[model samples]
Target chain A: MSVDLRSAFFYSRKDIFKNIKIFIIITLSIILATANIIVINGLIDGMIEDLVDNTVESSVGHLNIYPDNNERFIEGIGIKEQRLATLKEVEAYSPRISATGVLSNKELSVSSTILALDPDKERKTTKLLEKLVRGAAVNPNDKNAILVSSRLAEDLKLDVGDEATLAFENGIIKVYNVKGIIRTGNLDFDSSTVIMPMDEAYRQLAIDNMASIILVKLSDKSMSEIYKPMIMQNLDVNNIRTWEEETEFVSNFANSWRSISSIISGVGLIAAAISVGIVIYINIIHKKRQIGIMKAIGTSNAFIFTVFLMEAAIFGVIGVFIGDSVGYLAIKYFEANPFLDAISQTWISARFEPQLFYIATIFSFGVTILAGVYPAIKASRVEIIKAIWGT
Target chain B: MEIIKTSNLKKSYMLGNVEVKALNGVDTSIEQGEFVAIMGPSGCGKSTFLNLTGMLDTPTSGEIYLEGKDVTNMNSNMRAEYRLKYMGFVFQFFNLFNELTVMENVMFPMMLNKRSNYKERAKELLNLVGLGDRLNHLPSELSGGQQQRVTIARSLANDPKILLADEPTGNLDTASSIEIIELFRKLNQEQGQTIVMVTHSPEIGGMTDRIIHFRDGTIEH
Candidate 1:
């Protein structure tokens, strides 16, 4: 290192400790700014992750296999099920048949979608059983039992254990007992949907070994794109979609939240930069005479500028370190005690992302150094005669 | 040998909108190992002469030579490097850095010069100034005279060829002033140190080997 930089390092390090009180106040502001950015971003990421998880669990099970465009139902579904079981990538699969019907209670009637599923298979492929808001899940043997979504039950004034009659478009009518109430936070699914047993549905609709769609759960949801093509080739089906594609409704909201999070973080960092600049500027003003004396004694302008920048860098590192620790602890606390979201009927916790913390640390440090530049230049450019003589 | 020479050295700056000539058409030279005093009244360019010679400020269209090299138009960085390598400054205010210890203040020039064993050299200089025991004390902890002593010690840290003192004893008591002048005399006679001091006191001026008088921005014969 050059003498200017070396001397600057020495002076800056010692001076920071010498002026501990003022630097402490500056550091506190930096800590708050960094922590706010981290915590706010973490919460947004957590909410988005929850949305994606709920979409995968309650509705899209990583990947979905649908019938051809011209066909109402998939042919040879039993053979397809056997083929899907042979693939190691498939964790589990459930075939479902959806039929539009009129669901009526004693006092009210509403248009609803009757979704038929194998209860035992559905439990592995989706979260329908786990999301039960009230009462027990539908039993596979009890063909007369059914699960009704909270919104549909509310529209028909129906509750668990109540009898509701469903009239399909094919002139098939059946009365069933509502076994449970589930809320997936999916507006379309929760609003007007009723779940029933596949065996009973096939008998009532006069069909066998056929399904309108097959939901496939995978070991890792991120592999959906890779596995989708493989599944399509094996089943000879042209209609297949990944979970990310199936959750367009939630993805739009997630994108908006990400943009909002960036704006909030940007504002917070700018405030921190301004605070750092003002403090360093005031410090330079107070030490104007000292700077003049240094120049008089042959200290270079480069030395003066480097000293102030080094001091600012030290402050940034200390503050960001403490802020990162605080943010991490906060996320852990939130994880231990998650919020109960009424709409999703799920617990939401903050996500702790190491990549986000690293980026925040680097960006905050860079901003702090930039903030010190003007003040350091001003210190370096002090007129020796006027500064020393106070003219 | 001429250690320093000024050929029609001039400097000017605007006081409000009017240009004030601080120095004008002055020619002089100080031989090597000479102890000279520049005596002048207030507003007579004594400090300006000292500042120009010390490379702390630039002259306006005139030439200055230190040991035969014309050094009139060096930029700020080059001037700073030349000053560090060859000159030392003692200000009237005894401007020791208040935050640093006496030892550290003395070592500052050496640190800038990138010299090794600066701690030992600073200790030796402080001891010569009779502040060996006050090494760890801050500038604020010392008396006005002691702080001036520290400044003198700091000025000699780099072993510069010329020591320039601007009213070095102006803020000191009579007893302390005599001590500082006696220290300068001892340094000049014993070590052959070259010094150029600016002062208003004839008593201090009489102690030096030669005295140059100034009036209205020019030296009086």
Candidate 2:
């Protein structure tokens, strides 16, 4: 009378424990696979977060606002104060004039995208001044002041307090003294972008009181989605863009990475499962005679099968514990001192998220149990006479 | 008072598509509390007869009666249940699970049958077989004769009606063989346990109350 369900487990515990080598091998395989998934997932996730953060801090703020007609890049969005009346969550907002033009110095000339912005309001919206590597931030009062990337400064052969000429595609030209050299490290932006005062830009491009776009800032980046509707009802629905929607390439890269890593983890799990299956199959074959004798002595076939499954589950639990412990430590280490990618100048941190832990545990157990089924069936179907004779 | 009676019992095997008869239409009977030994040369089907009588295998054709009830047609699982309840078996190899201690091996059948107080029963059986002090010893730790004693104890774990032994001393030396035969003789005489054993040695057969001779899968006239 086995009243206690765990009696069988304790009964056979020594049988599996005696085979320490097999347990060690299975545990190591699971630990290695689980740790790999955790670390790799964290690294990829971290890289995408860094890219989004850099973009938000340097250019897109949180949301972009435009005029009622979406197709026409509707210059100024909130030139009339009533258009932005409902924006309570907005931390900062700036009106900007944007154009693509050529910048020329005494020796070199290169085509670049130009932004005309208020130094005070734009400072609060985009933090354009904090990215400065040299000189000072552009001033709205100094109509002749311009900001350039260090990379762009080198490309145009211009320096701070140096004279430079800015030309629009519509054949308009203006001269200004270089105010700052900023380095955001975003390759496309760093290589070809320049900035000036909104009034000076509009006057030089033959524009009037209207600006090209309004960049809005929210306290939290995630709040942009929630507040987008409230802000959209006051303006044009079709012309509103959250920073996440505007940064399509980052999301695309993140999505593609997720797909590729999932495939890699899938293959790793299969390999681990196959390894476990092979080991357990060999164990069943080795224990064939014992299984036969158990059946011969009145132990049911189902009992033998259940013991095998229990053995696999034991291995699964131990493996998950060790793997998750190691993985959690690795994540913490990487979170504190991230893996640096010198090429992108970004720190890739490993996040110790609860979801990753849950997934790793479930995956390890699922594959281990699935591996046990065939061997368990084989043990239950053994012929008692043959096994006794062999013994 | 027939404990087991077999009528026209036959069993056949396939040896690469050729039929080989292991038991051929044999009719056999043994009374309750009888100590019986079936004697034959190797491959004479004496072991096969004991296996069929123990319900370890089903007959190819014919019937087996246990207490006047037909059991030859019982399914394997039901037959296993019957084996657990009313039959015990001792193999020539003394097939104790290598990992289990002597007492644990004795407790296996009782555990399966849900017999309460099995731990105490297993201890008593081990003490009866004179290995009481060796309860915690693994089978590999004991000698061949001691291990055989363990098997005998395990066979009687559920206090079954009949003990079926196939070449029980075939692997023992002369001294151990005589010792095991005397043990079986004592168990039958004192406990009145019905035992059907198959053996090649006539010297061992002489100790039993009855000897049934078998030749080429049939009882000798």
Q: Top model by TM-score, which number?
A: 1
Report the lDDT tens digits of candidate 1 across residue range B1-221: 99999989899999899999999988989998999999989989999999999888889968899999988888888888888888888888988887789999988889899899999999999999899999999999999999999998998899888999999999999999989988888878887889999988999999999999999889999
Which regions of candidate 1 deviate over 4 angstroms?
A: A1-3, A154-157, A170-174, A332-337
Candidate 2 TM-score versus the reference: 0.90
Chain B alone vs. reference chain B, TM-score for every model: 0.98, 0.98
Location of the lowest summed lDDT over 10 successive residues in candidate 2 chain B = B75-84
What is candidate 2's fraction of native contacts? 0.27
Error of model 2, residue A370, in angstroms: 1.3
Estimate, for each residue in A123-183, the C-alpha lDDT of model 1 and write its tens digit: 9999877888898987767778888999999988889999999888799888989999988
Predicted candidate 2 versus true structure: per-residue lDDT over A1-391, tens digit per residue: 1223354575457566766887788888888777767777777777788778777777786988765574445644444334664567877888787789999997689899898888888888886668888899877777888899777899887888898988887898878799988777678878888988877887777776566677888878788889888777766455778998988888998999988888877887777788888887887888787777677666666777777877777778888888888888888888899766766555567667788888888998798889989998998888877776763
List DockQ for all candidates.
Answer: 0.55, 0.39
Root-mean-square deviation of each candidate, in angstroms?
A: 2.4, 3.1
TM-score of 1: 0.93
Clashing pairs in 2: A1-B114, A75-A211
Worst 10 residues of 1 chain B by lDDT: B184-193
